[model samples]
Target: MTSSRLDGTSALVTGGGSGIGLACARRLAADGADVMICGRTAERLQAAAKELGCRYVVADVVDEDQVAAAVRATAATSPLRAVIHCAGGTTSVGPIPQLDTAAWRDTLELNATGTMLVLKHSARLMARTGGGAFVAISSIASSNTHRWFGAYGVSKAAVDHLVQLGADELGGAGIRVNGIRPGLVRTELVAGITDPGPVLDDYLACMPLDRVGEPEDIAEAARFLAGPESSWITGQVVNVDGGHHLRRGPDFRAVFEPMFGAEALGGVIPEE
Candidate 1:
């Protein structure tokens, strides 16, 4: 179905420089919202902004001062109607013993703390006008387990709760808060893996839909959460995982066994 539901509305998307964020920004713009894309990288943000015909802001969500500034800047230019928290990254991967403290902390700050900042500032502004929508991009990892994904998963679990807290508090004020938890998606980050081919094949095998996710899949969900169609849907965590959550994940053991030799079978506790 087609929608001009967001006509005259304005949206600010963090991490909108590429990937799912960019897809959501463009979709919002097409649906009639005046969109704003923000990211730490100026060049990438500008390119994305230009493509979507939306404004761009350079702000690292992990930096509170930068986040506040970005919020103020967005407020100065438009009547903000929605905020999509998509700025995040997993800088490291390993079991706790092998994990770097700094990387773990950064992951928490970027995914959980950053989302809190965006929600806090945006809710304050949107509430002043008596309402808006806030949609966070969480991950299936929040409810799933994986090797070397502990820090990232924990942070996202925090985000899921945080989003609900925002929703519970703001729903009375007419501001709705929700989030989308996506499974394995095809993006630059996923492509960065050394040998994603076999791993992805295994992932696809477990999905009921038998396919990997795309940025647009998540983007469409974001648009729905942002628009009036979901007016009564607050404090919800929608999974756009192409049915991956319904089945067991790939056999990481078989995928990584050869690479790690006997160690993959000997010492490590196999993940589900």
Candidate 2:
């Protein structure tokens, strides 16, 4: 029975050019918030912003200065009432023993560090103006365990923890922080991984609802968290994964075994 409106406020969505980010941006705008989309690609951002009738800033969420700038820019037009952080992915997938160090760092920087910067900067504006809702997009990998998911899972786990910490710390400032853990969502960004034969099939076998999720599915959850309906909710990470959490995490051996030979991915404790 809540109005669930957000007139006169501004929102920032990282990775807003496409996929879940774009869906979230569209939904937030529909709820009456002025929206600004940010990402590293100018072409995609420009196209999405134009189509959505919103603003776009080409900024990498991993860059502190860029994140701060995006937050400031969003606030320039409105009080920056909401921020949906959807900018995350990882190149650090492989067996732990053979995981590339550089890729691991990159993953942490993109997912964990990026979330830190967004929360840090956006909270400042929201605190000064009044308060706002911040939603971090995490992955099912954070909660569900699987092989060859070390780096990405660890980074997302950091994000989940950060959401809780941010909610606890920033509550005094009237800001609320929450997180969403999406399951195998069908997005172009992950086409290479899931569109292929076995990955998608393998995922379905593990989902209780037994189907990949649409971008809009995640968007619906995000809209509730970002809007007034969930005003009292904070520090929670909701799973919009079609009950996938009830089952075991998807096994990517079919997808990853070839890339990382089964022999190498063979989990063995490295000598101390």
Candidate 3:
């Protein structure tokens, strides 16, 4: 029943097995784009692709060889109209003094390097055929940060810059590169950060919307960027953080205050 804005377009989404990536894949498909999804897990990728009426590929973004292959695979059978790079994660969390070098490296590899790989192959393919749209998933963490978010924030910062660089180089080829920086969205990835102490509540207090973002929220933005609606936009990092970045973030403890009750604020941690 939904009208499609991309009836003849095609898109490839990395990390499309779940979370935001899956959401983007579904949205693109709904918009009538021929979608191709890539993930490290074959089963998950296949399932997601089937559910979305899209194609599937198994590849790790951090692997250069695999990245090239993924691009070729997706391009071979589709018109290659757009690309959504969403394969990234935080490898570690903690103060700098306690940060693990390997973990930090892994974070950069997966986020920054991986983004470059996807864009690289996509750009090459798009260049040959004139041009296409490329959108990357960044994070609000890139601008606002805490002690434990160093690696994650830095990696996203790189992604933001990468978008600008892509715009500079690829614009001539008719390609538009942009990014979407989202705040705390409920996803399986967030569930693993138990020590963060209710990440959603921490973000909700200061966010103007007083609510956590949904993957669909980001999907809507990506849809715009991919379609002709945003044809004139490029090299921009759009904040989809429910205005969380507009206001000053609460103190670390204040951020988590919602997790505790009135009694806890008054005097006690409260017994479970």
Q: Provide backbone clash counts, one per model.
A: 0, 0, 0
Give me the overall lDDT of model 2: 0.91
Error of 2 at 54 (Å): 0.3
Off by over 4 Å in 3: 1-4, 192-199, 249-272
Ranking of all candidate structures by their TM-score, best first: 2, 1, 3
User: Where is model 1 poorest over a 10-residue stretch in terms of lDDT?
Assistant: 261-270
Judge candidate 1 at residue 171 and give its lDDT. Answer: 87
Note the Cα lDDT for every prediction shown. Answer: 0.83, 0.91, 0.83
TM-scores of all candidate predictions against the true structure: 0.91, 0.96, 0.88
Q: For candidate 2, lDDT tens digit of each residue in 1-272?
A: 87878888999999999999999999999989999999999999999999999999999988899999999999998799899999998888787787789999999999999999999999988999999999999988899986787689899999999999999999999899999999988899778767757777878888879878999999999999988899899999999998988878887888777887777667754565
- Model 3 lDDT tens row, 34-111: 888998999998788778878998999999999999888887866788999989998665545446789999999999
Give each prediction's root-mean-square deviation over alpha carbons. Answer: 3.4, 1.7, 6.2
Error of model 1, residue 151, in angstroms: 0.3
Candidate 2 lands at a TM-score of: 0.96
Which residue pairs clash in candidate 3? Answer: none
